[model samples]
Target: MRSVPRSAEFRNGGISFWFRELGCPERRAALLDTVDYDVCIVGGGYTGLWTAYYLQRADPGLRIALLESEFCGFGASGRNGGWLSAEFAGSRERYAQLHSKGAAIALQRALMNSVDEVIDTAGDEGIDADIVKGGMRLVATNPAQRSRLHAEVGYRQEWGFWPEDLHLLEHTDASRLHVDGTIAAAHSPHAARVQPAKLAVGLANVVEGLGVHLFEGSAVTEIRPGDGNARPAAVTEHGVVRADHVIRATEGYPVHPRGQGQEWQPARSSMIVTEPLTDDMWRHIGWEGREVLGDAAHAFVYAQRTADGRIAIGGSDAPFRTGPARDDNGATEPQTIAELWRGLARLFPIAAEVPIVHAWSGAVGVARDRCPSVDLDRDTGLGWAGGYAGSGVTAANLAGRTLRDLVLGHGTELTRLPWVGHQARAWRREPWRRIGPQLVNGLYRTADRRESRRVTRTSRFAGLAARMAGREPHEPGPGGNAPGSPDRPGAIGEASGAAGPE
Candidate 1:
């Protein structure tokens, strides 16, 4: 559905996030006031649209409908950091412990391959996603961070051999990239970057092109089972449509009222974009207009350069909130901007002086274990998928296809992957979910300080250095599919045999 474009005079307000450029909106989509469809989706963001797109393509005659609350591109999908990185964000060791090795590998393989899937989609849709393909680089901030990287390398090897894509960049070269005195940095060609908003809009365009029914300004308030061959119907504020199957693709909005344990916590992560850099600044920083970069700093700042030439740096700094929150997520703390500026100065002094041109923040439904969840409701034949922490660009692409396959009653290697239904332990109702993020946020701050004080590695192979750090100490717990029983929702994965021991 078309929305009146937000005026250019509008300011960034309390937030400071800026995303890739996407053009004009169209007239609002007409509501499906009547008739029955095979399936109904609630949410017009990337995950919802992508699921509808593939599902319709896979089964053409199957009538499908997607309803968006506002105009498309109004959520995190259009307001993200625009990093299309392929390297999984969750620790590799955790992956080994969470899923069966084979299933983990398959899941990782699908996620890794989905990088190309985005590129292909952009190409097929004739959308310029501003994809830069050189790779993504992970810079280490302290000595302990080195161990984590080495451990990840070993664990990655343990699971399956990846290409020799990981490059161990040391000192002088590291400093050249603004990461001076860093212990070590890992570079992988497998990762890529792109313009986010244009991609989301392009996805919406493709969904419409496929002749699928996508309604904007339609927020589904309820889903009730229908009679006979017609499935349950999705009712919205404006109108309603009867359908056979309903897919609750709402990530931020957890509409499962009675299912307290089936909740997904919402988190508010923010970003800031600098004014276009001076030409001299770019030559020295030498990302060479390629690759997104993040350091092993416990704070985990991820930065990428935009096609229009601004630098977008994003980090988690606000209290986590549940449901679709754009403004109420909290404001940008002055201290955070100060800390981020210091970080930028540490790497690129010249770029630090550039005035910040834009800033904004959005919420993501992040699970405690830092992985997305794909759960199903057998009684209603309803499927759910969300909780992607922050790596949703590529993960959502793969998840959408996987979600589609699962909804269509097909089995996939992705279905058996460790992450699908394996959510962390539940928070007892309210106040806890709100308080828990601050707790985790505190841990992250402490961890960052801890990492900074650790020693730096001197050589690529200091003979014994890599060996000690690379040692595979112990196997992580419950890494693969638990075959015996379907777990009860809200139970910890470990207790349910869906994850490693607590």
Candidate 2:
């Protein structure tokens, strides 16, 4: 069914195949003169774009300006695995412990709603990103994984989730979905597949259509919040953007103004997309519905069947750089891409020979407590949202709506969500931040290897690894499920580099 030739080789380097459909958005003119607006947003990824969209809808007269270092969606937004699942970054218990259970549940419901909101809005806006609402399936290949998955399902039911929201499936039932080696699996109907770059480009265009000033290639060098009496301003090398409010929506990228380095840790994720499969290959896989698929591993993998019949798989085993640095260009490490190919082959052996057509990597911001936050300080007229921990495609939309509510001082249900006004602890500097991700990655892979050999009980080493990695013990690594969902718990650049597409 693929129109593209199977002989097509890898498209190496930064640009993903998703971004090529639009033939690369011409970089808009940079801001060269001082400009004044009612609102100034830094980072033109989904967070900024969505925030602009909602804000303009709420009040069209609000003068808003958005600045991006590169083109919009050039960061994690353009390069993610395109999963719009209701996966909150932190544990539901964590959210409840920090705030109230009501608040936690409210946030969970909001996330579930955000997925539909995105699809509905995209339709109304005429932004076709090859969207498919097949939902998500998480397979457990080992007994240990099965145990954890069942526990997750039980926990979700206990939390008052309807039986239909999340439930387990037998191996036979799961195999029908093309996820091989499925001892057990969890299914959730609240997910969808998307073409990440197309959605990003579409949003950028839609927001521009709404009269929002989008400045590409304009990197913000400084963010100067105003005193109680004055307005805040974002300083670019060529211009200054003064506004009543200043927003920092940079996810996965380095912290700007040369400070707040400890505020967020940069984690990288890489992915590889295989050449489009033939009809015979499709019959072999048996995933005609094309539900977004993920597996249960200490170091997990996530995948989706591209509209073009290709398979794009992603994971976060790449080494972490020192000083919390990020790779702006979506380039992949050879080893990372190879590992991803191996993961894809393991899941679908019939396509083991499928050529990988593209590979890329991106970075995402990780908060200290592994939870995202949206906060606005009316005193300083500063608002920001990020730290999605990797499951941010849908979370970003929620964050944008939350940011809009906070900025406008409406304080509806969006603002009442547990993540609103949250200030996670800062990550440790250098040795701890740099060495932590590597240590965690090594431990997870080791745990996965050991668990694969065992027939009963989860590995104690895996639990330790999860704890060290700042994830809940027994959860299926980082890409498990929504924190409070029946499946288990769970990112940001709209699509943090940890999860793929980026």
Best by TM-score: 2
Task: List the lowest-lDDT window of 10 residues for candidate 2.
Answer: 484-493
- Per-residue C-alpha lDDT of model 2 across residues 129-236, encoded as one tens digit per residue: 888988778777788777767776776665434678778876676777766687788887878889888998999999999999999999888888788776888988
**TM per candidate:** 0.80, 0.92
Model 2 scores a TM of 0.92
Each candidate's number of clashing pairs is 14, 13
Q: Provide the lowest-lDDT 10-residue window in model 1.
A: 493-502
Which runs in model 1 stand beyond 4 Å of their true positions?
1-10, 13-20, 23-27, 30-34, 89-99, 160-165, 170-176, 180-183, 225-230, 257-262, 318-333, 375-378, 420-427, 450-502
lDDT string for model 1 (221-331, tens) is: 776654455456677766887766677776654555233364455555666667778778777776774777766544456677777677767666533233334454224
Report per-prediction Cα RMSD to one decimal: 8.9, 4.0
Please give the lDDT score at residue 297 for candidate 2: 68
Quote the lDDT for 454 in model 1: 49
Alpha carbon lDDT at 413, candidate 2: 82
